[model samples]
Target: MRTIQLKKILNEHCIQFIEKKQMDLSLSIEDANSSLHSASNSTAGDKHDTSRAMMHLEIEKKSKQLNEVVQLKKLIPILIDNSQQKSFGVGTVVETNAGSFYMSFNAGKKEIEGQSFTFISLASPLAQAFKNNLNKKEFQFMQKTYTILKTF
Candidate 1:
């Protein structure tokens, strides 16, 4: 697989995940707000208590998921859309003799064209190995050495 192709795949995956996260957050927020409204309007008794408890849980869960979605949104800008130039940073697709790897800086593994490539975060250990290196440099991962064939 080529670096450009791998990059396209990673970009698609990131977009899909972001969309799903956003949708989930929106739905959760709506549900939580509705639950709160219903709890407030309840006549009193077990129904009110149950609604209150459910609302609290929904709010907590939604808040956590919203935070995660925000973080993921921040990473969207890191992905390089221009394929003209290549760099040794997150969002850059790296090609090695062994296989292609997409450095998402946010997303996880994504398979492309029958090749199981690891879409690693920039903070990951393997990414650190090639952090500041340029194209044609050799990076060692675990016990294996991979030569940087190309970047895009």
Candidate 2:
């Protein structure tokens, strides 16, 4: 399959992943709230207070995580919008001597259309190397030199 098609598939996979994470975190927060309610209804006790406090912290943490996931889900399409690139940009994949990387999110590897693609954040060291050297075909990261064979 072409890189454009494969990138679209990768984008869909990333969306699915974000949705799953958001759902899981939401459920966790709900469960924690329920536990907190149950703990509060019980008689005042040191253990119960501590349990409630812990549940409150858990709920807060999960809610923050869910918010971050929602932002990331919104960003995926904007970053990988299938626009034509003059040089390597947000929606392009950089193929190097080391491996193939999708310039989207750090969603790990997925095999789509018989091609393996590693979704990486632009802030990542490897992606940074590519982003900085968009004009050049060669760059070094982690003591290894990577030569960009092509961009998709």
Candidate 3:
């Protein structure tokens, strides 16, 4: 598949994943807040206090996750620039002996048009190795050498 097409697919998948995660986190936060409010009005002393505290913790956790999702959403477009480059960089789709990779985000395995591609962040170990050895025909990571089949 073409790099632009692959990038588009990965972008859509990443956005969908982050949005879905945000929705779930929002729901959890709402539920936790509701429980906390209810607990505040309860007559049960110790149990009510404990329940409210736990709900507060839960809200904090879910709020943190929601913040992360929002950050990820902001990061999506920065990596999708379709600049032309001979070597690997952000927005490039790489095919190697090891596997196909989209140097965009850590969205894991994505299958497009019958081909499997791993969506990885540019800061990933493998991508860092590739960065250091730009234009090299092959490179080794963890004792395994991967031939640079193509990059676009």
Candidate 4:
């Protein structure tokens, strides 16, 4: 596992968490505004209905964002230290003949240092493929092949 790749993975996770938080905040503000509008126009049933609809949409958006926040919280602990990661733990970078990749507890893909890398959560299919593989070994996915060259 390359240190640079691990750092990149952690940095990316941090950015994603920040973005999700921003989205959550924005949705909260929108929801509040919808409620206020609905209150102000209570005399008009149609306007109140429209505001209610908008509020529903905002609630859905906030719910999704909250779910994302929960996922991000699970990832935050792992991202805190890219270095000194436990063996076979999430956020531990793995070096392969194909390239350097980060093993995340959250599934995703990323590129680092001009190299394309796959980010797989601990429970992901690809992570399971490589898990418990102590020695250098070959891993095949969708006809593409990669070898676990080393572990840092």
Candidate 5:
């Protein structure tokens, strides 16, 4: 497949993942809210207090996670701009002797069109190593030398 097509596919996948995360987090938050409500109605004093506290904490944590997902959702569109892919940076697909990677965000490994591409974040150590070897087409990680096959 063409690099841009694959990139677009990966971008779509990222969006899907983000949407699923948002939905899941929202559901968890709702569940915690319901639990908090139930806990508030309980007659047991100390036990009710502890359950309410736990539910509040859970809601707070889920809200923070949802906010992070929102921020990540905002990043997806900006990061997927169809500019030239020339270097080891975001919005580029890099293939190395070790494996193929799509440098966007750490979406983990995905099998698309029967090929495995590890979606990685630019801030990742592997991406940093790739950037350091951009010109050389080779890098060393974990004591094993890997060569850059292509970038798109």
Candidate 6:
């Protein structure tokens, strides 16, 4: 399997996730704004004030989520760096007894063409284990032993 092709697939998945999250956050923010505007014109006294406060909280929460999604988008290129695959680092695909992993983001397991690829960050436990012991035959993780078959 080509590592470049695998990286492209993983990047596509990450982009799709970012797009979906952006759309969801946008909708949430719009809804919160609408509610806040409605609360402003209402004359329910204490109830209206409470509703306005709640809408403000919702907008704040959605704003934070949007910020996080934007940061993830910025990290995409850095996550999939096209560097030399000397050892298990960023942009490298590691094949182990546990599974095939694209060291990118912690987006969890992604199955493409019937094969499973667990996208993990370099700071993750599994990636840390594969750090210095690149070509080693076996290693232990969570009390379970795993063999490093190949890395690219």
**Residue pairs in candidate 4 whose N, alpha carbon or C atoms collide under 3 angstroms:** none
> lDDT tens string, model 3, 11-57?
78777877888899999899889888888888978878888888888
lDDT (Cα, tens digit) per residue for candidate 5, span 56-148: 988999999999999888878666774255655778778888878887777778898887889888899988888888899976788999899
Number of the predicted model whose TM-score against the real structure is largest: 5
Candidate 5 TM-score versus the reference: 0.91
| Candidate with more favorable, higher lDDT: 2 or 5 | 5
Task: For each of the candidates, give the backbone clash count.
Answer: 0, 0, 0, 0, 0, 0
Worst 10 residues of 6 by lDDT: 79-88
Q: Is candidate 2 or candidate 3 better by lDDT?
A: 2
Cα lDDT tens digits, model 6, 13-111, are 877878888899999999899989988987878878988998999999999999988988887777566534565577777878888888776777889
lDDT of 4 by residue, 109-150 (tens): 565556666655667776777775646488677687878876
CA lDDT, candidate 6, residue 106: 74
Candidate 1 lDDT by residue in tens digits, 1-64: 5656656667778888788878988887888888798778868898688878888887888888
In order, what lDDT does every prediction score?
0.72, 0.81, 0.79, 0.66, 0.82, 0.81
lDDT of 5 at 73: 88
Candidate 4 residue spans exceeding 4 A from truth: 1-9, 12-51, 54-58, 105-110, 132-136
RMSD of each: 4.0, 1.8, 2.2, 4.1, 1.6, 2.3
Off by over 4 Å in 1: 43-54, 81-85, 94-100, 130-152
Descending-TM-score candidate ranking: 5, 2, 3, 6, 1, 4
Tell how far residue 4 is off in model 5, in angstroms: 1.9
